[model samples]
Target chain A: MSRTEAHPEPPALAPGEVRTRWIVSTPPILFLSLFFLAPFLIVLLASFQYPGEFGGLAPLLAQGDSPDHGLTWENYQFFFSDTLFAEIFLKSFLVAALSTLLCLVMAYPVAWLIARSPKGRRDLLVLLVILPFASNFLIRVYAWMIILGPQQALAQGVNWVLSALGQEPVNLLFSPFAVLVGMVYVHLPFMILPLATNLEKHDPLWLDAARDLGATSWQRFWRVTWPLSLPGVFAGSALVFIPVLGMFAIPDILGGTRDMLIGNLIKDQFLGVRDWPFGATLSILLTLAVLGLAGLATWAGKPRRGHD
Target chain B: MTRPSPWLLLAAGLVYAFLYLPLAIVVAYSFNDSRLNAEWVGFTLDWYRTLFNDGEMLLAARNSLLIAFTASLSATVLGTLAGMAMHRYRFRFLPFLVITPVAMPEILLGVSLLVFFLQALHLTLGMVSVILAHITFSIGFVAIVVRVRLHGLDEKIFEAARDLGATPWQTFRWVTFPLILPAMAAGMLMAFALSLDDFVITFFTAGVGVSTLPLQIYSMIKIAVTPEVNAVSTLLMLLTLVLVIAASRLDKTFMKGAA
Candidate 1:
């Protein structure tokens, strides 16, 4: 079916049958302008202004007539110049990347299971993937705390097994590794859902044809299935990785104090120190990074799905 | 595609285990009589009783529900209009303007909204700002959902209605509204859930004056994990699971009818 297209102009309205698609469209546009775009623009502008002790925002707009107030790159410089902030940024990127990689590896089989399973069972399996995620994310992370805490059964059991082998016991909590585990657990469903969507439409007939041509299972997968599923892989990775970068809740609850992520830094800036200007700067930069990655994902998801 | 191999089955099973292990622990620990360990100090209903009487937790719950319902209703209305616009008219930048919020990190949104509320609008950081923030981000989800439903629409039905002497409003009320109702419900459900479970954006935008369930729970966790918090978490999980399952069933029935 053809899509419902917006008329360039109402052709000619009958006296009783008035048409105002433009008017119909106004509410959302105005809402977006008021709530989303305008505020976002303010953040962009605010990030460039000079920062003060508590918050750089006051000097910029709250006291506009003050001669000392002007645009400066100092807020950005503050974040970049500090090695601690730099390390945090790097760790955020690294941890997000690693989590995405782990999710991809773990998600493939689950996606395949849901995609290739009996049609009647597909929705149930999909719901299973989404259920844990639907629950409060904080609760899920809390669950991990219980499992990974030093005195927990799993941690102690692992430690006991190691000691039995005459090795040192592992400290699982408050570590970067714990953060990674939390991230992977949280985002695995995201990776699987998109891949399952892409894979569900993949015809089993291709495998039969490849086998008829004497292609092995691995060869058929590598040659046909692998290439066809790339869009889903890219899409899912973007969904998983970007959020993982922004979500510091897992890291905060699970990660140690030494290595902070960007999310943690932003929280510290805004909530802890109450520095609005510098926080806005960091947030803007993080927003840009997320946008870049989202663009890449869209670019990758486009070539295959564009026609559909 | 014929059948998954043994390794694939095993790996998928492991993923399910990994996903549920934490949640299962939360439920199991809610009843733990012991303070912080898995010693199984014997199961007790004391935590549930504590949660019952916690005035702050109850207040936070009420606030979360109010914001969720209000935000979801408004987001659905606004998003349905936006979705209709995209379907009927060709706006050049609607997708970017509408969807960027979804792609934007929650922290940035919180920070931007904070600046906008405090500096530009001169509004206090409180419940009003939190609702607006939730609505702002949530419209994207509703828009996307409604858009998908719009795409699945059979344009011929609308054309047929117009041909049969139905006016635009009459045709929409008689035909289009009925068709998209389920999708709208799905969108509303998702918006409600997103608002309820929201943390990162809510955290940043919510000044000290406002405490949603998440913020309240966060402060509680920061202090220490208590059995009461575990009870709250369990109840929250139960609520979420029910809503999500209901939503999935709705979508399934909707799709079946649409097909």
Candidate 2:
């Protein structure tokens, strides 16, 4: 009844001819168990415990006197207890949503452009999308730091113009806008990849047919192109949204110390507050959220474009 | 069909601009002579020399390269087997489960793995722990890549090999193995790149002074950005750009050979 029933053969693989199905898959099965499943299980168990000192956990069944004491919902309660915590949860979701939206807007056109290009150009564009991701993410974020720093050229230009107009130069770094800019910068490629893959598979003949039938370009897009591209949009959104939801580095570097997201909250619990149990609880909550989103995406993936 | 709307092309150009400009700035600023990043002084390579001379930075780079090499090798092996199994057999939801490590927020993976090692296994956190952690997350990337490559392979070839009285071992060695080798290598390279660039998971698993290049860069930036950080970052970007181009070339050659 376990989910990982190792390689139950379908009717296709004749059972007698094979040595055994499970034998071949055992290495990967064991690898996933020892590394992934076991660690996740530990986190789950730890999440049920009381917060002990310095990244330690009290026994899950231990006794408690106060709300913050042993083996209580206290840790979980405390995390979601305040309005600020709730605000952070909502804010993280909103930021991810907006970021995904912005990525969609920027990426769809680019993905479409790449898909429609000739082989040489298309490969070049896709390479452009991928080459950046191969570099360090922190380095890229740090790039944004200097670019938007008050003393940087762009900011200095703004200040020069502002001084002429007798207005003060604006602080750009460590703001919500800067966070959005960084999120869009980092996540754009993720959005582009899926959408481009889907678009590349689309037959240009569909567009030709619609045009020959006297449909306007806009009508053709709305009637056929948009519907056909929903799967890509869905896939891209899922990819972009999930990561942006748990984004720590961007918010930390760009959003400043004032605006806290769920990742920062979780990081604080472990490193700053030293509440291992509460941090574990938050991790579990995020895992569930991730799974839920993935499930929703899978369910919605009807592949109605008729291309599977 | 309608020439892709000039607007789309413009947008694509802008997207590329957005992606590369920050990186270009880093590369440009690495040559900046002034310690202050605000204004450019005369061009100089002093920062590059500084980064080269920093013993700790080089050690971290060496550590990262070693760990990435080993982790990617193990990941390639695990991924190849998993891809073959998924291709040969049917397991509903297996693909979904396999991708969870990659799809789940990396922070969760880092935190959970850290807790597992420290609290549950009581394993010492160092290069070994970091390598194990890298292999764990990277397996999914390799598996997905190898699986996609395997999907394009013709199953009839396997049947033909079998019909010729080749044993399963021979079929795999001569037929399957040769065909998927490029993909496996690409997967490994990608895993290598991912391991090299990882920060969040490495941050958690690499305990007690075991710093990778990204961790080294992170620490450096956490205090303040210096010319050395810029120089080192530009070098990382250059390395990655080279790796990606090399991997893509391999992929293209594989496609040509397949065709």
Candidate 3:
């Protein structure tokens, strides 16, 4: 439902009702303003301030002699000045795109099957999709560590195949391959659930009508089902894509020396190198990137949605 | 309705297999006698025994439980209020504030909270900070669940309570509270699970010396490889499984809220 539609019209409040409404709403408003909204503003401010001599940020206000002790656009400048940072941003975008695509491909068949299944079993199927996701996120990543460990069966089997093919044995863990696997494994449900929800709403009569017109199954799917499912694909992609873009843990745990992404770079700034300004700058840019892409997606989807 | 194609069934089956195989391996290997997660040597309870005895792991678990309990309890109360507020009155910022945290990439929340605690609040990164971060994120989830519950309900019942001699507080305490109890329960469980499983935000906000199960698990996964990690993972999965089942029983749509 549209948010405006959800709200309807606000009624005039009685005096006591006004107080009751305030009482009901104030606690959360105050709490979120203090913690949620304030922190974001703080991070925005932190991004401009200079790094302290020791660690964290320098003073917000200028000291007696040193204007350099206060704010500067140095953090943002450093981001734009360095090709390394740009490359990491590009790499993260590529990883997010690839993960979304992979999730889409893997999720489509499962979503289609679930939608076409007996109505009695759809909830159970959805639950099955969500079951793995409900487990700890780190545990899910660690599962891959076990699976792709050098001495594990999957790796050993692959290396054996490589050796027989006259190639050197390849390490599976601590590789881009491992990171992609982790990303897809963790995010697949995000794609599946939305896709299934959309697919479940499709009118079977449309497909049947096409079939009766002597359309091939491939034609029916390509022309009808695929076109109708794009909205679902877009929703699922946004859910998978945004988080994957900022994901540090998957890459941190699964990637090798060469496979650093934006999340890792930002994390390194704060936890690793103790540079708060740079970290805050990266975070702000990432937030901007997410918002920009989301705005673009909504704009792109508008015409298609209007067509439907 | 016609049946799904055998080919489609096979494809979906493979996807399901892909999803479960890794987790199944972890569970299977937790009991393996080998020190490494490589191959099965023999069955032993030694890893679980090791997990029980490890002081750090035990403390982390205790901290996690405490944080989850405190955070979820507070979140449920605040979230119920937020939900009711949103349902009753139209607001520009309330829904935005509540929902954005749920929608935003979690790392952003973690990083911002880290910045806030260190710089703005001048607070130490420890259990209190971690709990606050947990509550901040979890409130949105609890609110969503409670809102969904409120949406299905008929307003006439509350109106009827007011038609009688019931005051606003009496109506809320006697009528509204009982009606939304299941949702409140479901929301609390959802929050508990979220706070317990949280890693990214807790990692940023937990500072030094305050370890949750996830932080402990992350270090163990990164620095050391032992069947003990597997044991802990298995137990965590089991705990989540129970919570999910309990939450779903309380409210079936909790699964949807969770997703």
Docking class of 3: medium
lDDT of 2 by residue, B1-259 (tens): 5587777778888888989999888888899998977777889999999999999999999999999999999999987777777667666545655678888888998888888888888889999999999999988877777777776766678778877987767887899889989888877888898899999899889888498999999888888679799999988888887777666666553221111
Give model 2 RMSD, 1 decimal: 3.9
Q: Which stretches of candidate 3 lie above 4 Å from their native place?
A: A1-10, A64-67, A300-307
Candidate order by TM-score, highest to lowest?
3, 1, 2
Model 1 bad stretches (over 4 Å) = A1-19, A52-56, A61-67, A164-168, A304-308, B253-259
**Deviation (Å) of A231 in candidate 1:** 0.5
Q: Write the per-residue lDDT of candidate 1 for residues B53-112, one digit (tens) a residue.
A: 999999999999999999999999998888877776677677777788887667777778
lDDT by residue (tens digit), candidate 1, A1-308: 13444323346645544345766678899988888889888878877876564563657544645554668788888887888777878888999899999999999989989999897899788878888898997887777777888988788889999999999888898888899988998778888988988989888998799899999989988987878888889988998899899887888888888758898888887678877678778888898888788888888777564333
User: Against the true structure, what is model 1's DockQ?
Assistant: 0.59
Once fitted onto the true fold, the runs of candidate 2 whose alpha carbons sit more than 4 angstroms away are: A1-20, A61-71, A159-168, A209-216, A305-308, B252-259
Q: Give the winner by DockQ.
A: 3
What local lDDT score does residue A271 receive in model 2, on the 0 to 100 scale? Answer: 69
TM-score of chain B of each: 0.94, 0.93, 0.98
lDDT of model 2, residue B239: 87
lDDT of 1 at B165: 96
Q: Superposing all C-alpha atoms, what RMSD in Å does each candidate have to the true structure?
A: 3.2, 3.9, 1.7
